[model samples]
Target: MSSTTHNHTDASCIFCKIIAGSIPSMKLFETDKVYAFLDIGPIAPKHCLVIPKWHGAKITDIPDDYLMEIAPALKRIAIASGEENYNLLANAGTIAHQVVMHLHWHFIPKPDEKQGLGVGWPATKPEKKELQRIYDELKQKL
Candidate 1:
């Protein structure tokens, strides 16, 4: 982890306050490993956040156990939201516009075509040579 990343600011952190029960939330479900709560500022009607119990500034900073807990919690939220589809988003860093320092997953449920999370995909595709270069570069890091 980088030194610039503030691991957590418990007393001032909104997520920490939520986990501490100091902040009220529309509780959906929870486990020893995770907590699922309705998004106070929801993009969709059933938009919610699935967060690990342990505090971490970013996804890369979270422990393996906490990371592992996300999948099942996401599944539960999807079913509870009564949606067959969902959009999972995790904003990582300052450039990505991660307003909250705590690591969390946005599970935006979309039951209907019009009333759900709207996603925008880039139209451009990288050239084959560029793709190969990227693949090689990533593999080298591994």
Candidate 2:
């Protein structure tokens, strides 16, 4: 991690304090763009959080550096979880039940014979033409 001082606002955000070194954590790894730490509350064995060094509520709001840092940090978490396969999850809006209001990816290791985190599967049915139209719109923007 670079020796850059971050300007974090202390607004009752655990992640902000974690980045600021104001809160104690079982640190796993740290980099200029992200932090890897054990989840105080774990949904699965060896669950950890891969949080951006900066605070942002949603994935779309995250800066490029933060987005780029995720894969490497996730690798570190996987190692901590005994290199077992893991699920990388991010809850994005109120409907998703994002509690912290900070963008953080959960690295939950799936060891063996356990049904991991469950999620609802919402079906979106559209015609081929509609799909093509949506793709075209996105491609045009890109």
Candidate 3:
């Protein structure tokens, strides 16, 4: 793991306030690197927001170790919520409906088909050759 330190917190960010104990939130779980809390305006029965303790406006800005640390928290939250299925979502920018500047992951437990985060993806079935080309391009970049 990287030994980099990130102690800066944005005073204006709502998530930062929540982590700092200035703002009140229904906290579900808290670790050294992450904080999980129920959403005030829940989309599902146990809709919650998991965020890194370090303040980062976007995913690219956050450290990889911090992002990786959230996985166990998500698993615990999902199991505690008593839902077998769930949706974990993170919107990066305004176009993606990210209202808060701080990076946070939404965990929406879906006990049934009708509830939780519903998505509509307009997808296309491309030819294998086209798929291979796209994969190759991405692989080269990686």
Candidate 4:
């Protein structure tokens, strides 16, 4: 990261501290735009986090140029994990289970059912008319 970009960090943010070297991390990989490190409380083997060097509270807060570097970083992390199947996940807000406010992508290796990210899908079906109404609203908003 450029010196000016490195300065674009929040002192109160743990992730910012990690990127700044104030807090230690099990370092994995890093580039000028992003950094990947092992999760202190990993859900599975090789589980880690990929964060933009520039701090952002959420995905929408990141610029397009910085966002461009995220996918390749995730790919490198996955490849190094040596797992054929894995999950790339990011939680956006506190209500969505984002414990950390900083924007980050989780690279979880799913070696087995017991490992990696686990969740239960509770699906619901609404009336077709309701679905149509929602879709129309979204289409117009898009």
Candidate 5:
């Protein structure tokens, strides 16, 4: 871990305040690199927010190391939430409904469409050739 990742807190950020023990939150889990807690305004029953301890405004700004470190904690929270199925969502920007500027991942235990995390994907059934072409293009870029 870099020195930049150590105990840094933003006074203006709510998540920072929560991490710094300034604001009260229903903490679910905590580690040196990450924090997990219940969302104050939950869309579902087991709605939890997992965030990096570092004050990252968006996914692009957060270190990849911290991002990788949060996976195990997320899995644990999902399993403990007691829902067989769940959705892991991270909105990057304002257009994506990221109300809080901190880099947080939402773990919503989805029992049904009506209850927990409701998703409306504008999916299209593309031709096999089109799919292959798109995949090939992405693979080349990668």
Candidate 6:
């Protein structure tokens, strides 16, 4: 991450630079709204990233149209990677391990347990009443 802070349109954004062709990338596939490229430092073989052309620091900041285009492009890139075992991941903020301020998706090929994303669930069993109450609250909002 550079000293530049997150913004909707930033001149110092690396992903934006890639989208503008000001910086070189191992281009995989591109549409008018999205760009997919091989990650320079990959977690696994054929690891790649997909980003929207419009500058948005988080996924929620992206326009619905750009978000829609990104999903299919990532699917195509994942399928073309020639690895069935893979992980499709995205992070929204620094706390979520998002180093880049630009909104992007990671298509990481997980060949085995030793590679790709290593996840752990620090889960706790909540009381049934609590679960039901939470579900009801969300459902009511919906």
Best by lDDT: 4
The sequence of per-residue lDDT tens digits that candidate 2 reaches over residues 12-83 is 888888777778898888888888888988877788888887777898887787789898888766765674
Q: TM-score of each candidate? A: 0.84, 0.84, 0.88, 0.90, 0.83, 0.89
Q: Per-residue lDDT for 23-96 in model 3, tens only?
A: 99999878778899999998888899999988887998888878897889888888888888889999999999
Give the alpha carbon lDDT tens digit for every residue of 8-125 in model 6. 4568989988877789999997877888999999988899999988788897788898899887998898778789888899998999899989999999999999989888889999
Residue 103 in candidate 1, Cα distance off native in Å: 1.2
| Candidate 1 CA-lDDT value | 0.79
Model 6 ranges with Cα > 4 A deviation: 1-8
Q: Against the true structure, whose TM-score is highest? A: 4
Worst 10 residues of 2 by lDDT: 1-10
lDDT of each residue in 1-142, candidate 1, tens digit only: 3112334336777887777677888878776667889999987788999887777778777779778989989887787768777798888887986889888899987767786677788788889999999999999999
Local distance difference test, each candidate: 0.79, 0.79, 0.86, 0.87, 0.85, 0.85
Per-residue lDDT for 55 in model 3? 85
Per-residue error at 64 for model 6, in Å?
Answer: 0.5
As a whole number from 0 to 100, the lDDT of residue 13 in candidate 5 is: 92
Residue 14 alpha-carbon offset, candidate 2, angstroms: 1.4
Better of 2 and 4 by lDDT: 4
